[model samples]
Target: MPGERIEGYATDPSALIERLFQQVAERSMVGLPFYRPQLPIKACAFQLLEGQLFGALLTPWMLQLMLLPGPGQRWDYRRADERLALAFPQGEILFRPGEIAPDLYYLSCSLLSPVDPALSAERAVALAENSVRLALSLPVRQTSVINTGRRALLRGALSANKG
Candidate 1:
């Protein structure tokens, strides 16, 4: 069957991104150099697809990440629209806002363009592995203290009410 959603769990968006990047980087399919950015990712959503891994990260602003099975290349941007004609000869990049949250958006990529549904299981696994490595290598963003505080307060209140 095609379009099978692989089962995976992440503690949070950040954790998920880290796991995915790690998987991609280890494959060494693409040369990924370490980079540290000032802005931290607020959240992320990632998934393993047959020939690609699709996910979005919220850095208080939205950014997308995609991985495919071809020559690995890296692309980064602060404003989504900055690179209108940018194309990933090895892999392409695209972004969209989260359905409910405008500040949040999604990033998607296809390892093999014109994705072949009939792609071999082994190939699919390889692609998925690379995607995960890419996710892990991605820069880790520090969560805002205000947001952390809010979460803690909410958790405490919920527990108190339950008791």
Candidate 2:
């Protein structure tokens, strides 16, 4: 049963991850106060980036960004839940080790914990897709200092940063 596909879905990049979380739900998440039966485990945008896999995940209990080592990549395993930093195109984010199988792990940055029961599955998936896209995009440009002050200062330089 270790590799059983959930809900008859074929293998995906996070299939191992999904099975791991499914085990967790079977063990302890079913009766949690905030656990909603309507919510299903989902993975979004799980594609390789610089030889690693990055994606967003939704479980009945939490929403997170996941980073998994791709083929031939091995991680320097860290203690589960210990804070670590992982960089995406957007920026560096705090992550923690997530154990998928014995000694096999992935990293995750939680976007939401103890997921709200009121959240609908469709909306949750949308949010996960958007989160993945945002995480992989370049960081938003900082506001120009000159724009915050006097406009006449534009004479200082032709461009915002140059001034």
The candidate maximizing TM-score is 2
* Predicted candidate 1 versus true structure: per-residue lDDT over 27-98, tens digit per residue: 542332322222243223344444334443322112345432211322232343333222343343443212
Worst 10 residues of 1 by lDDT: 96-105
TM-score of 1: 0.24
Which runs of model 1 end up more than 4 angstroms from their true locations? Answer: 1-10, 13-104, 132-163
Return the TM-score for each candidate structure.
Answer: 0.24, 0.75
Error of 1 at 136 (Å): 6.9
What local lDDT score does residue 112 receive in model 2, on the 0 to 100 scale? 89
